[model samples]
Target: MAETELVCANRECRIAQGGRCIEGHDDLAKCLYYGNEPEEGDQNEADDDQEVIAPFNGVYLPDAHPLDSRRADRVLASLPSRMIGVIGVHDSGKTSVIAGLFDLFQMGPVANIIFAGSSTLHGLEIICHDARAASERDEPHSERTKRGEVRFYHFDVLRDGLLQSLLIADRSGEEYEEVADLAANATTMFELRRADVITVLVDGRRLASSRDRADVMGAIPLIIQGMAENGAFSRKPNLAIVLTKDDAVQASTRKDQVQRDFLAIIDGIRDAFASHFGEIGSFVTSASPKDANVVRGAGLAEMLEFWMKPGAEAQGIRQHSYSGRVFDSLMIEEAKRG
Candidate 1:
């Protein structure tokens, strides 16, 4: 029998039993001490396979910049457009109403309007962050929206296979408050002037609170008066008076009184600016019914439905009109009364 040859126990040793190591001392090209090393290409492919792909569902602002006007124009050109303006005071649930509308569309289509896309997904996300975080943490907290940043959320309205575009502008409540207090014109005021529909948000919680009631009720007429003085309501947009935080009001023992007070405020608006508004409708919404601390969206469908319908079709719900001469007479009468 031939002499027994000793084989190296190192699995990485490339040399045959009798072959010269190429690693200087033997025929193998490398040393077995470092173990087997994969080829560069193989390693790269392995890394590629392990890489994670992120979800790209919605479009966001570029570096927190506003949406491009050219892009907006291009979108508007192809489809019939409707512009909705949301107006309210600070902590009056403007953002919550917007967040609720966004949430409603995202879940599925709203009546005939389907979710086509949004240029302000990140903006919506920011507004709804608290509600989402609360749900995740099993805790409740209010969502605070940033001020001075007015963004537009775009949607594709689908009806009978025809697609139309709807753009809703979410303005900062503080901005409206400034205009109301100073009686000055701002960029948001211009948007309001051109909007096809306007949703005026009133915080029901504040309405129910005796401490905040006066200021809350006082602010509504001021905002409307400011807008009217600045010609923001010149085009006579359809109006939806949205009462937010409805759940809070309903739960309170003083619900009847709060409702009465809110109705009185609405009647005052009708008397003051009836001719400047077309097809006015009142809506009560609770954006966050499940968590009292954070506002989500509830009773938004009816509000959206009111917004989506045409002025002529919605005439039955009209609480006001756009009578130019009558409005002038009313303003004159109010001035004399003052």
Candidate 2:
């Protein structure tokens, strides 16, 4: 490391002589362009740490698909990681939030967090495609999580100068509503049982409507009670009551009223369930909002930071052993009878 070394090995960045960074960074060393150029015979060394996306022999890597619980275990076994489980009703903006976080990384750092890499790059890109201008859609739309079993999207990020692994579980919101309908259904949500953070989303658009608001808000208590009875919070993970589609609420004429209602729900949940969780918090996010007035990814960075918090430490390895779908119809029948 000599003063003569160019930023990121770029010849034009004569930083030793005070040439500015190509990316306008004050310190050339912090610039993306500022790194050692791959030295001769260095490709093999770099591949060794390639987020396990490296191929078996340069052409046999695992498909970049969402990780199942088993696959997720293999990754967790190798790296220190945090698991976040997102639960909500239909169209609650789960996929949009996940896709928005991915889109933010494409532009550059988010909240000063560096995107190191992802194990499910293709899967992440697929969810984000329709929302991008590249899709040639007149209006952007998020791809909803397909109704099925739970799957995880893995991201390796460098935050606060340290590399950390994040595993965010994605499941159809309809499926989560089923758990709200029957507490016993929660037993099948192994992801939540294993989660370090469990985020509950309420649709901000619904919050803006007087008629629809009650149904939407009422579901929160039912979902939490169901999960609690099923032992989903046995480990006491951090609980987050997240309001999605803040843009919708902002556009409503009763914006102030809606915001207050949302805050009231957060406070009520805290008072009611403080003992059931390790920590309880709330967040507002407007990920991939269609309203032009709303900053496209507003509040997502803060939401991501919350997920990255050292909340309820991760529990021991997950013990779910489902063959196909984790949903157990027999358990639901029993719960109904009881």
Candidate 3:
């Protein structure tokens, strides 16, 4: 089949083609005058070139279901479902965690897990540090910078015959007050709404600090609770409270007390979450584990597997909850069902 192309030329009307606008006409007076009208033959040549050179307009590629396609049915049939959502918090190490997971999933034997690495979820990113910009107007505009809003990155892990992906959304660091304002007033709501799950990253070491504790703890829960009350959380998405910068927490401890400190910090976070939001699992994540710490280095993969497991919500609460093969777990469940 021969492909047809279209173009438009009216400046006011974005859709234009062949020196004429999609409206089928344009005012020559408003257009830049070339002093004289071109010959009909020349105009025709230009139109032909535009038709040849311009990309096809008003046509979007159609969506096709892989499972429904005859050629891909078998592979698609074996593919498992996906669970995805954005992880939140300014210091939450959201990007670092996602990046680490991408590396692990790509290199590991797990084929069922997939990572869709992208930053354009509905075309939004935390572009500016909103609070800083608002607070320091006296600072030179050049000195002020904005962190882009979070984008969605996809991670899929397929192993033991199950295929699922986690779509991670991230945002820039800003004060909770600003996030609340934006959440309440912004026209773009999907960024805050599109999540099958939401992992609120908490700064573990700072949880007890008086300087910024309230901003870190209170802001996040308030926003989440408000969302729940407003029906946004009706899906009752599984919430994962991640304690970011585990390395920092570990580094601050005495050599002999490292394990105790780690456990205590995690316990504090878990307790606080239970007190405030009623029991969410807390995972300690170290993006940059110290050399010689192989056990800690593997934390990312371990956490990913735990969080993405099929029945994690039910099973996560009761167990020591580490070192499970998600793909193997899924296979066992499916085999039993059959």
**Which lDDT tens digits does candidate 3 get at residues 231-261?**
4443345556666666656555442343444
Name the top TM-score candidate: 2
Top lDDT prediction, candidate number: 2
Per-residue lDDT of model 2, residues 164-228, tens digit only: 78899999887888877788888988799888899998899998998999988788888888888
Clashes of each: 11, 3, 35
Query: Between 2 and 3, whose lDDT is larger?
Result: 2
Q: Give the alpha carbon lDDT tens digit for every residue of 28-121 in model 1.
A: 3345532344466766777898899988999774642234444556656777777788888878887667777777887887665677766667
Model 2 lowest lDDT segment of ten: 329-338
**Any idea how many clashes model 2 has?**
3
Mark the regions of model 1 whose C-alpha exceeds 4 Å error after superposition: 1-74, 133-143, 186-188, 290-296, 312-338
